[model samples]
Target: MVAEAQNLKVSVWRGTGETGEFETFDVPSRESQTVLDVVSWIQQQADPTLTYRFACRVGMCGSCAMMVNGIPRWTCRTHVKKVSENNTLRIEPLRNMPVIKDLVADMDPFFDKWVSAEALHHPTSTRNDAITPVDATTPERQAADAGIECINCGICYAACDTVAGNPDYLGPAALQRAWTLLNDAKDGGRIAILDAVSGSGGCHNCHSMGSCTRYCPNELDPMSAIAGLKRETFRHALRRKRDA
Candidate 1:
């Protein structure tokens, strides 16, 4: 259908928060043109006041993530030809977050969840202490390695249904970060981190629907990380009961 068309019909959200409407624009299509390119064209050619966010054009930064035709994706990496249907495209801000403006969701809440989950590493040894060597072959190291690549793109957060149902939910990325820290051998706050993620609105709230894993751009399995948190929390609960 798009083969015969010289221009693509793109509908982009135009407002702040939930008060937006889709504004249609006819974008000229080109070979290898990406969704970001379409949005940039609309802003530059059609309307100069249109607002959006993007940093690295390459896929490494994950700064160009947005909802492309109802799916969260890195616009910098998503080619318009692949996602557009019949030469039509719909672009919107990521869901389940406060939108600051068109295509720019406030990332404060997402990062706040990371802090609430205690996702930061707590060092066990001081710099004055002897250097410690970590064995990469160990299972704990492997587990930590599995989730260490997340760039906080928030794609998985937007894809999570639990976050939609429960605003207080920690979401996948935060919980995945907690799991990575939990497996870290030199981390001093294992028990405290476990306590943080095990409470209400934490890992227990995840429905394990696998939406987070399904939309993760990095191909990381956050569902597996959440499952790991569930098991570790259960073990901790059991140990506390036995100790009591």
Candidate 2:
């Protein structure tokens, strides 16, 4: 029991995979406390057995992302006072992901989906060839630059309702990557990438709810990228029909 009246009530999910319960903790409240600080205190003072992931306590690394009050946020940067209501906070592992432990979500499936979307860069020229100069003034280069800042943070994936309902959806991040690569002048996998995204679980599967863009900590508009893919794939389809 909290001996003082100025304590924060925290409910954290504790379980592996899909099975577990929310364990409540009473943490002393402070003026400048972040949610990460509360979690660290719980592990050190409350329960040493508690498990969570964090690095670079700043916002640079997104490893500290978790569901705080049903929204995915980087715990390292999120202030406790800003998100807490009535000094009560409910924390859980990221949704739409399999929990490996108390606060760790398995990221293999997310990356696998990324690969399925053909988000990787495929070179157009051999390494021995001269470096190709890309002009930033071009629309293609600008499009790629807009989303190149993504560091594979799963926050957007967790925020996407399409991913939650459709097991086959390629996801916003993956599709956004595909759009970036499609706009790259040096990318040689345009046809394959287009073909992959044009099929089932592709860009069309998106409902355009914009949840991914709305919750992105980086403020990237993945919805716009997906929209670009829709237009590109439509034009690609028309060209194929015209040639046939």
User: lDDT score of model 1?
Assistant: 0.91
Question: Which runs in model 2 stand beyond 4 Å of their true positions?
Answer: 1-5
Clashing residue pairs in candidate 2 are none
TM-score of 1: 0.96
lDDT of 2 at 115: 89
How accurate locally, in lDDT, is each candidate? Answer: 0.91, 0.90
Alpha-carbon RMSD of each model: 2.1, 2.4
Best by lDDT: 1
lDDT (10s digit) by residue, model 1, range 30-98: 888999999899999999988988988888887888999999998999999899998899999998989
